[model samples]
Target: MNSKWLWPSIIAVLLIAIWLYLPPGIDPVAVPADSDSIARGEYLVKAGGCISCHEGSEGEGGLSGSAAVESPFGTFYASNITPDPETGIGNWSGEDFIAALRHGRRPDGSFYYPAFPYRAYKGLSEEEILDIAAYLQSQPAISHSVAPHELPAWVGRWQMLGWNLLADWKEPGREMNDDPEIARGEHLVRNLGHCSECHSPRDALGIIQYRDEFKGGEIPDGHVEAIDAEALNSWTEEDLALFFLIGMKQDGEFVGGKMEPVIEHNTSQLTDADREAMAAFFKRGLPASP
Candidate 1:
């Protein structure tokens, strides 16, 4: 082997290793009918916050895959994840669903780009993932089919597979602590909250900058959002809670941007206790001034 090629080869090997470990995109579950299963599935859906991405807004048919999500590269439509056999994941099996969520691949065996949030979802447990799939299946299937994302020629669709290899994640689910409050906050943030997905910055390869930890950063699409503990610490816990509830600050400032969808889909739906728990976790983790 020529010494000149060593660096490239090493890089290639590392990238392959990373890709091999990325979570598959969709979690397929056989439709479950047991009451207990449905109940568990419901909780898992709330925990995963699936409705935020799949549902459409006014004028945009609801859950029919017309919701356009704005990203730095371009606007990508949120596809239908419902159980519609014609257009959604309806025909998928539980193993397929698990593979997608834990690994980032579709049932057809294609890689799912990080834009789908499997990066954060990789932490979900198998049991929890099953529940989520069950819950999804239980929802009324929507029949709207959307077009594939149209990327600029410079960025080919297949190129994303290589990118997936570079940024795949395999961390275990959120850890629970003896402190109920702390544990609750951690669950809300790590699982349901998905704060890290947007707040943390991604490298050229699109993997989140874990080293920076929550120090605020740009998204893969170049949109800026503050996740820094210091900046978050500036707000009082109460401020964070109120902001989460209504997407506005205590001072009457409106919170907008990519976060708007999150607030609309998930945060606004959280119970007061969960919001307070999130605030508690943030206040403790974020220092007053970093």
Candidate 2:
């Protein structure tokens, strides 16, 4: 070996070692067939935007994921998550589900691309995860096969090893609001809602910038406005809550674009109280502007 290049080669080997070795938890259990748990799971799934991301185009597919997401990296297709024995998660145990949600690892022990948004979901409680699993299990099995992600030719699943190593996440806003409802809303926004995933901008590696969270930025299509108190000050919390259900603004303009599905499937489905909580959560710290 050439003496001059020896050090570089050693460093490259070490980097590979780190990536491979770090190739990275949850109880393996069956979901209860009870309706209550399943119901809760259904709600959580909606809150988590499972349908928005996994639902087939125009509601034709039910968690038969193939929803295309355009990003800088490439167009990634969501995978089927229905209870199909062959094509879906029918074989996945509760632990596999938990691992996928909390740790971003597939049942095969491979790293899932961050497009799955497991980083934000890591905060979910074990019971919440179980409920989600229950809800998914109850859905009718669909043997829909999904297309593989069309990321750049240079991008590969194996490359995720290196990508995961550099993962860092900051809480969006940890200020303890005295109001329990507001706190719950925060939990939903940060975790179940995964609101920051879209509303916030990302670094070069496509990680959400929690510190600048709700201070929206650009997406593949266009820019998302900041949703912080200052930005939404003109609207009362009541109006905000109503917006979640109706997707209409006080200005009479309806929310469209990427948020259409989110409103139609996720936030619009929330209970009134939960919607109020979310509205209060977003509008916290500022009184409605006169």
Candidate 3:
């Protein structure tokens, strides 16, 4: 046996075996098709901040996917999430929708750019994901074709595989010892709200740095920095809740810039209890300033 040929053949066989065993996208499942399911989806959409990106700010376009989100890589135009058969997700199956949210893959199996924030969304339960999908399907079908991302040639769908390798893709679970309020906050902040996706700094590879988690970082496009999570310690729970509810500080300073839409579309829609839970969680984690 020739040593060089033997090693090359063995490596080729191993690579082939690995490819064959790779899991395919999850099979399609039948989601609930009822008004109650759609209503639940609507609530989850707001909680998840879907409109903040899909639809431009209040004065801009509607949820027709006309928004262009700026990022370190380039400008990524949000896709049409409306139920338009031609340009939106109207034709997508339940599994197609779930795959995009949980695995960041399109119906054709192409990867979505991390700009979609699907990493945090991956923590959602299948029921929740399907509910959101059902709600999207109920929306008026708007025909809109988003512009392609302005990325470098080397940046492609395949690159997401490497990114996923380093990401926390597991679903979030409950802690038996966690306080109820704190637990609710953890779910909102870490899973549904995905607050750290923006507030934490990312490395050159665009991965969030866990060591600096919740410590302030620059927003995409380098225009503004996200407030550090610890900074909330300086604010009273009432103030924090007010900020989430209305984007206003106790000092009468209004939240402007990118956060305004988030407040208007997402946080503001949360129930008072949810806001209180978030406040309690933050206060419990960070010490109040002396």
Residues 1-290, model 2: lDDT tens digits: 99999999999999877666442434457776799999999999999989889996555568998888888999889899999989899988888888889878888877888888898899898889999999999989988878888977888876776676566423433576789998888777878888888888888878766657677878788998788776787888899999999999999999999899899999999999999989878888333334
Q: Which parts of model 3 have CA positions greater than 4 angstroms off?
A: 1-23, 56-61, 169-177, 220-229, 286-290
Arranged by TM-score with the best first, the candidates are 3, 2, 1
Q: What tens-digit string does per-residue lDDT give for candidate 3 at 56-140?
A: 4344355777687777777788888888888888898888878888878888877789889888888788999999988989888
| TM-score, one value per model | 0.78, 0.87, 0.87
lDDT of 1 by residue, 211-249 (tens): 554666664456566656676756888988898789997
Worst lDDT run of 10 residues, candidate 2, spans: 19-28
Clashes of 2: 0
- Model 1 worst lDDT window (10 residues): 165-174
Candidate with best lDDT:
2
Runs off by more than 4 Å, candidate 1: 2-31, 57-62, 154-162, 168-180, 217-223, 286-289
> Candidate 1: how many backbone clashes?
19
Error of 3 at 180 (Å): 2.2
